[model samples]
Target: MANENGEGEDIPVAANVLGTIGTILWCIQLVPQIWYNWRRKKTEGLPASMMLLWATCAVPLGIYLVLQNVNIPLQIQPQIFGALSYVTWGQILYYDHGYSRLKAIVVVLAASAISGGLEALFILTLRIPYRKGTTWPALFFGIIAAIMLTLGLIPPYFEIRKRHGRVIGINWFFLAIDTFGALFSLFSLAAQKSFDILGGVNYILVALLEFGIYGCHTVWRIRNRKLLREAKKSGRSVDELLEERELERQRQRELESSNGERFTGIDYDEEKSRPSTEAHSVDGGFVQEPAGWHRT
Candidate 1:
């Protein structure tokens, strides 16, 4: 769909280099997250929906790349990227959602197959129109891909909101990789001979949202550091401090409830029992776990 006579545009060298880096980053971005989930035996604050949405995104994106006949790495990226997303999503199911190992494998494999088939079908459907000098059809797929991609990043923000402005329960390394991938891909778009509005918008949305997450992380970390110092100064463990904070938050929640009712039920403040209910549980919980200073 490059010209009315049917030709492919030349991919500029800068674009090629940048696109390759972005492709590589995205292709393997989820590995760290998957490994983190496996090592922790929990998904924690990572949202399963984000992974699935990304996996779904690969379908339309694969079709767009196929029809556009882009660079080799770019052409292959959506496929591998989506497959890895599926595997990562499966990990969430197994570790976070309590799916059996066998079930997770089965689900991931099945979803991958269905997604691959759907992508192929769309490519076949659009290939003729694209060759006949129609660009909008292929462009439509790109737009859909972009929308799906942006949607995938939104779930984490909700998790952050639920945790009261904290971006918690995700691997910092994983988030860094994803944000860089989007940023590099954006630069790659700028390097192109002609900017793809759809693609540019996608990367922009991703970068902006991820940067916001980083901002939230920064603010949360700064405040958390102060709390850590106070905890240490008072000869109270971080867990105990967290317990008190959680109890206070619970009281706030009860106060904010629409029922206009509040109840006090804290058994700590001056002192608390080991493995207290208010203590952020390493053994009993990791969801939205506070990033307190490491004791060891």
Candidate 2:
């Protein structure tokens, strides 16, 4: 039961305990991302491919959620978590490149209009045919979904990375929360006396994937730090490291030119000092005393 706060006071203790645990995990997961993004102000080296893959995974899970329709206390299956996941993704986008409130309102209106148009074309005009269980439709939409998700993740990734030159400020706490949330989800599923339903399995899988993502990201960040250090030692900056290497070629050219000049100077002096055979004969040509040359 909630205390004097008057917020959700009378729920069962199990659900509350599960929710609390899940929430802690969610915070763990989210805090790192948010902290890195905010403090380091960078998202560079974060693979857009990874995020795209994640969103791809999310799509199938969302479909599964719809297909299984598992119910739990507090609607604790994928429905609540799934929707929350989308919201979190949206927040990521906003955190990176959010618009002003008024501008966001305009964008929302515009998006609504576009969606309305599409709905009209499909539902009202009946121009689009509805097909079930077709491979072609699945392939077409699958590619489209992949492209759209990739596109959505691209901007913020670039924006944050470009801004901070690294993914420093990202929140790690959020990741922890999410990881724990998955465990709680697994527990909750086990709590479901019915083993026949797919909800628990689905949540377990989701949690596993989320944990994998966090693990990979952590390793990636560590490796990236080493890479950056190496880059700096080699006299390169994050954005222009390659360019700096190209500039080093100019240094090489200058060094080669200087060396060539020294060698050429020595060769020229040697050639000039070579005595001509005619100098021994001294015929017809007035033999001037060999010009006294003094090495300076």
Candidate 1 Cα errors over 4 Å, as ranges? 1-8, 230-240, 248-296
Q: What lDDT does each candidate get?
A: 0.78, 0.45
Q: Write the per-residue lDDT of candidate 1 for residues 1-296, one digit (tens) a residue.
A: 11101136677878767777777888888888878888888886789999999999989888888888866667788888898899889988988798999999999999999999999988888899888988798778788888988998899989988765676558888888888888888888787778876667778888898888898867876878988799879999765888898999999887688344322223343234433232344677754422443335
Residue-by-residue lDDT tens digits, candidate 2, 1-296:
00001133344556547755664453335445545654654444444343434434334333322222223322232223333333334344444445554563464445444533543343322212322333343234334433443343344445444533333333556545655675775564454433313334444555555455455556655756765687789787654764565689999999999999999999999878875332322455555344454224
| Top candidate by lDDT | 1
For residue 109, what is the lDDT in candidate 2? 49
TM-score of each: 0.77, 0.39
